[model samples]
Target: MSRIVLITGGQRSGKSEQAEALALSLSAHPVYMATAHVWDDEFRKRVEKHQQRRGAQWTNIEEERWLSRHDMTGRVVLVDCITLWLTNFLTDGQTTEQILQDAKDEFDRLTAQDATFIFVTNEIGSGGVSENALQRRFTDLQGWMNQYVASRADEVILMVSGIAVKIK
Candidate 1:
């Protein structure tokens, strides 16, 4: 069975760095799955910075919407983050159920592959309550998605201040 590792934390909490390190330890041919979409110049620069940081050792795949069901034999796949992926689905007029189903399908695909999966997500609920309806709805859906994925994960880690705390 493929090993699934879920890493989650606040922004700038070093989750991505840890995920990359774990992937390097697992396989030489690491696949970096980027799910972020550049909305503005600032965001584009941020994405570029991440890409530059990953360097040439990785086969970078930019997946903004639905994650592709690919065969990952002899590779370590790192999903840099899932929050942006969820936002893409949510903003694209997709229902929460649909988004979850899509993620479930992707998870099934990932699990079937002979690869070490490092899934990264953000801790969005920690920002307290949101007054906006869309924000609240998005947070709820993200929380649900995180719980569901973590349940299926072989290992779950919470990164805080660059420290990794294993929760499962």
Candidate 2:
């Protein structure tokens, strides 16, 4: 059986740090599966900073989408975000419903493997409604995806100002 853990919070709330720690506690050489797409130089620098933090003990996999393609069997895989992963799908110009369904199916397939998964995600809908149409759409998509993942997670942690609050 696979163990699924979800760590979610607002921006800069330390969700990734907590997820990495949990992954390290579970396995010495946990896989750091980053879903970010480096759209510019600044973002590339941010990705590099993350790589530097993990040290040489971690195995990093950069997969923007199609997460199930990678065989993560018998390994602890920490996906450092769902937001960016979903954004990749969004940019493909798929309908909202289609994207959501695809994400859910991909998640189901990935979780079918016998591995421990620590997912890091942002709780972007926790604030006031966004005025931008695109932002609002993304927020809705994010919330639905978060709910789906949380429902299947064995444990859920919400990071607030560097504090981990168990919400499973």
Candidate 3:
């Protein structure tokens, strides 16, 4: 059976770093699953920075949708975040239920493999309520997504100011 670890936190809260460390500890050659869809130069720069940080040792996989369709057997996988992945669905006009079902589908397929999955998501609901409708909708979707992944995860961690707090 596959092992699932869910890590959540606010922006720049060390969630990705924590997930990367844990994945490396689990497997010598873990897969870095890049889910970000760069929308501008700034974001592209950020992606470049992350790529530089990971270096050539990690196998990078650029996938934005249908996560379960990928073959990840016998490899540890690090999904830098559920937030960006879900955002892709939302931007593509996917309904909340559809987004969730897709996530669940990925979970089901992943658990049947021999891979160790580390998922990083943002705890976006903790901040003050959003005034924009789309922001609000995204927030709700992110919350639900985090909950679903955490519930199924063997280990759940919350990163706060670069410190990892074990939650499950």
Query: What TM-score goes with each of the models?
Result: 0.93, 0.98, 0.95
Residues 30-66 of candidate 2 have per-residue lDDT tens digits of 9999999999999999898888899888998999998
Q: Report lDDT (CA) for all predictions.
A: 0.86, 0.95, 0.86
Q: Which residue pairs show backbone clashes in model 3?
A: none
Each candidate: RMSD: 1.4, 0.7, 1.2
User: Model 3 lDDT vs. the true structure?
Assistant: 0.86
Looking at model 1, the pairs that clash are none
Comparison by lDDT, 1 against 2, better one: 2
Looking at model 2, report the run of 10 residues with the lowest lDDT sum.
88-97
10 residues in a row with least lDDT, candidate 1: 65-74
Which candidate gets the maximum TM-score versus the true structure?
2
Q: Name model 3 segments beyond 4 Å from true.
A: none
Alpha carbon lDDT of residue 134, candidate 2? 91
